[model samples]
Target: MSQQKSDYIDEVDVDESWDEHPSRDELEETVENLEDSGFEVEVVEDAEAALAFLQDEIPAESSVMNGHSTTLEEIGFMEYLNEGDHDWENLYGKVFSIDDDQARADARREAQTADYFLGSANAIARTGALVAADLSGSRVGAYPFAAKHLLVVAGVNKVVEDVETARERLHEFAYPFENERAQDAYGVESYPAKELVYRQEGTEGRTTVVLVEETLGY
Candidate 1:
């Protein structure tokens, strides 16, 4: 089946400034700052390299959970988790398989503490901050502290000037796309009810940011 086109870009009001991309020098600075902030940063050549790195970094048979991220879907991680012949225990798959509604909800909450949690940020600042928001707490909840290991995947386009700009990008860019996705996928409108601003990783080696050189995600 063909995927439906999203008119989200047309539906929402956004400032053009939030959509700007950083230069090579700016990206380098962001990477350095992110490293200093205690996040293990890996700058990949492109999305393909990013996917390869993820496949290698995550060991077989490990429990894996991921929030709904367009970046993950764009890079084929979603399909890989669903159908790829990997030994990892897919917690998301298990959550979706449960027929009981309350049981499924409980399972989803537990999945936040999986061996590895994967997702993306809406914006990354040169000052080493990460911004993301979700209508439900399901996605951003695991990012702060719940997951044993967190892997955030993002593209260079998300990198902005500072923490302030990151917030603007989250509202102007991320929210519209997510709102449209929610309506299309779940038959309801969405809002950024829950927000997360990740300034630094206090735990050593707890979080890794895979930064791709391409334009991706919202």
Candidate 2:
């Protein structure tokens, strides 16, 4: 069975203060900065609106893939990508369908370059930086340039004061929850082997930040 947040909430020690949503001023400033940094920003009211935004933004025939993201799962994107009736090529499904271990690994790497690659960030700074890390490079590797387009969906709760606080939130807040989930799912601990501080995106229209109003992920 898949690991859920409930399974690890009590086991981890995180700062509850990091889970609070930012104020309207913070949200507006963050959005403006993000847009100035060359990221397409979309603020949605809730999870349903976030999902609807994705469905409308992505074209019918594009190839799509996503890294492991609790926010994405919480928003029902994972289930929709696997089971929903959509015309997009599900590169993720195809990669996992391979029975051979070597082939599957190769497919996973190849899928990182999909037409549309989606994932969530651990923290988003009010100054417009995004921070995320993974035990392996599977998730953050595609964010910089490999994928044709990158979509990052994060909740307002992730917003911090600056890049330093963003990284602090990643370590003190996000890592605990992710570590618990990793242990439950893989029977092993997780580490932030590769970290990313995404300050700006040079590619116009290549990266989109979908910020949802509600707190959805660690």
Candidate 3:
């Protein structure tokens, strides 16, 4: 069955303008505040630069894993992990390659402990808080503390004025697209059963946010 736009958004109403790109000044302020909140922030020109930055950040032979993220797909990180000349363990690829269902599940859980874990945020508040929701905890489970290092990649369009607006963006924008994707891919509906609101990074250099200038993901 084909997905419909109304299938997701009908559950929660939100302002359509929340999806617009932020101004340069707004992006700059958000970056400063994110840095003050203890998250390493990098502003890339586009998805290509973001992908290149990711390649440089991760070292060879390190075990790497990632949650499902359209931003990462847009940046070609997923394809690179599968087909490129990276020496990292590529834990996600390994987990999916397992044929046994239980073994695959076990591998997925084990992947949370990978040296580097990457994903995208639903919304990033100018106040420096990050918001994301997931149907299963597998993706977000590593964000809090499971993974050794975390990288959250997002587009400038995900930035908002505050935490409240960030929440709105998740419900209005992220949820709808994600729900449709879940149905089409998994033949199941998705919900925000697991939600993450990252207000600060207590450990220095534990997490980094790659904010691309272009509009990239949900």
Candidate 4:
């Protein structure tokens, strides 16, 4: 869909602190302020800590459901899990994409049984809102409700100005990643993500977002 055609969405402009991209110093200040807003905050220097937190300390269950994102692979996630620590009796991505029969089964089984869930976020507002666009449903659906605890991991590049820009960034960047995610999760290369995401409107769920300071995938 054309960008303008996608304008019938809720409009929330970030007119307060993040009217523009926060500088390094401003970014720290913003993070501090956001942490004070009743949300748990963890700042990692680079992708290494993010990787360790995701694959090791977060939690390990028989099933670990995740989106088909390149960031996970870039951080040596598959290697880390394949090498050791992660149990071998569970599933990963089954229906998170329109993949073939085995891939579909993998995603469905993982989402059904996984106690620990993780996925990349397109943007993390200073208000601690986790934003994403899910076509295969891995971005937010499984992470927010299916998992015991949700860890929203995003590279520094995903951090944007405010809520409005965050939504804009989804169209600019996330859709493409979703396209790749579709290809990997299935095996087809023509699937593009639909612009529908689930948010925590009236749920008392806890979502942990780890913001990294280096450039990473979408």
Ranking by lDDT: 2, 3, 1, 4
* Runs off by more than 4 Å, candidate 4: 1-22, 29-38, 60-62, 87-89, 93-113, 180-205
lDDT of 2 by residue, 55-125 (tens): 99899999999989989988889889999989999998899899999999999999999999999999999
The lDDT per prediction is: 0.87, 0.92, 0.89, 0.56
| lDDT tens readout by residue for model 3, 63-117 | 9999988888878899899999988998988999999999998999999999999
- Model 1 residue 139 CA deviation (Å) reads 0.9
Question: lDDT: which is higher, 3 or 4?
Answer: 3
Candidate 2 residue-wise lDDT at 97? 94
- Looking at candidate 3, the ten consecutive residues that score lowest on lDDT are 1-10
Tell me the alpha-carbon RMSD of every candidate. 2.0, 1.1, 3.2, 8.1
Q: Which candidate is the best by lDDT?
A: 2
RMSD of 3: 3.2
Over 19-50, each residue of candidate 1 has an lDDT whose tens digit, in order, gives 56688899989999999999999999987898
Worst lDDT window (10 residues) for model 1?
A: 1-10
Per-residue CA lDDT of candidate 4, range 1-218, in tens?
Answer: 11211131223332222223446875676466455543455678887888877665455444565655556656666556555566533345234345587767665745743565666676666544556766655445665456766666666666665667778777655555555544545676533354433334233335566777766655
Using TM-score, rank the candidates from best to worst.
2, 1, 3, 4
**Looking at candidate 4, what is the lDDT of residue 163?**
69
Model 2 clash count equals 0
